[model samples]
Target: MLYKLNLEHILFLDIETVPQKPNFADLDENTQMMWEQKSQYQRKDEFTPEEFYERAGIWAEFGKIICISVGYFTSKGDSRNFRVTSFYGEELELLKQFKQLLQEHFNQTRHLLCAHNGKEFDFPYIARRMVINGMNLPYKLDLFGKKPWDVPHLDTMELWKFGDYKHFTSLKLLAHVLGIPSPKEDMDGSMVKGVFYEEDDLDRIVSYCELDVVTTAQVFLKLRNEELLSEEEIKKV
Candidate 1:
């Protein structure tokens, strides 16, 4: 089987983010200048890490979690499915639940935890949150200094170009190039903070995350030369 399909492991993942809250406070000269020179994309409600922190509901007090979506696929299958979970309320409690789920379903080395830009964002966010909540880092996450190519840590964005480390690719752009349908709806990452603060609806965030995971899985499938799924073969729930 290993020779036939080149299979190795399962994939787990998570995303940490906050809503883009309003910046009604006094804008610094630099910020004001930047806003004045905003591009069409820049005009959209996207927020920087600092902006997300200022107003995101979950991060407002204890930091926001927006959503965490996990995808699992085998080398033999064309379709990869992601089980996206959402967390609301206190950051510490949510972090605890997230840790429990990882421990319950995944064992480091047996399964890999995958993310798009997780090395910089998802994993570190989870680790910091765990420590803040008085919990220890998972063994898999604690394995620092190991090369990513040698370990289960797979970042599709990083792998898309085989670590040339230039020309970052957006998940949506990748899906388009591969003929995979984008899972993201009308809302982009920037609007997440608003959804949390203005809408207070966690389900929206969860659905958005599911879209990201599905897109990620689709990209992975394409890279492995597996058949892509038909619309009927994919199910959100």
Candidate 2:
């Protein structure tokens, strides 16, 4: 099997999610139940998703997709540029626009969609939401059913499994270990809902998502020997 992906051919992406409401405490019983079940697995710290929703209220009222950010690395005359686009607002319309733009600008034969932890979260979330809105998925998304090695997918979280699944490493920790500065150290996924819904600061969410994709791209470069891995601790993980 060949393992060569043109850095230019890969578009890195990340997304932010929160509930559609203003407060989880204000959520109806059914919505609360839904959040509880989904949160059961997602919550690792002492706070369950329900508890976090009650405390933070971003996810409870914001309705999941606060922002979807995509970044592509472009090189021109020895200059490397990271170009980014962010989709935020009522999910249904923005999602359609995001997909349409991607399809118009990028095709499967040339560009491959990539993301961090995208297989489990970002990709599926986008696909399911697209289906919910009666939209067509991009061509490469259909490749998901094929063997992992055959697909264009490259998830850093899954890559971490090269060491062991026993220890969970976040994008921040991975970046730190690899000596890549995390542009998002000041905030994280947990704060996404609040920063977006409560503060009406969609840009922050977009920035956060963009940083995640950039970090994912950095991680991928290190993995592929396209870039240097600065920290020795990265090998341990």
Choose the strongest candidate by lDDT: 2
* Candidates' RMSD to native: 6.6, 6.1
lDDT by residue for model 1 (1-237), tens: 212422235554657476323452345566445444442253346764344334333332234464666655433355443334455456677777667766776665566776777666677777766776678877667767777555656677876767487768888788898888765396877777667667877777777776687677667778777776555554543
lDDT (Cα, tens digit) per residue for candidate 2, span 21-75:
6676787898788777766655767786666664332332325566777777667
Candidate 1 ranges beyond 4 A from true positions: 1-8, 19-63, 74-89, 145-150, 231-237
| Runs of candidate 2 exceeding 4 Å displacement | 1-3, 36-63, 143-147, 163-167, 228-237
Computed on alpha carbons, the lDDT of every model, listed in order, comes to 0.61, 0.69
Best by TM-score: 2
Candidate 2, backbone clash total: 10
TM-score of 2: 0.78
Question: Measured by TM-score, how close is model 1 to the native structure?
Answer: 0.71
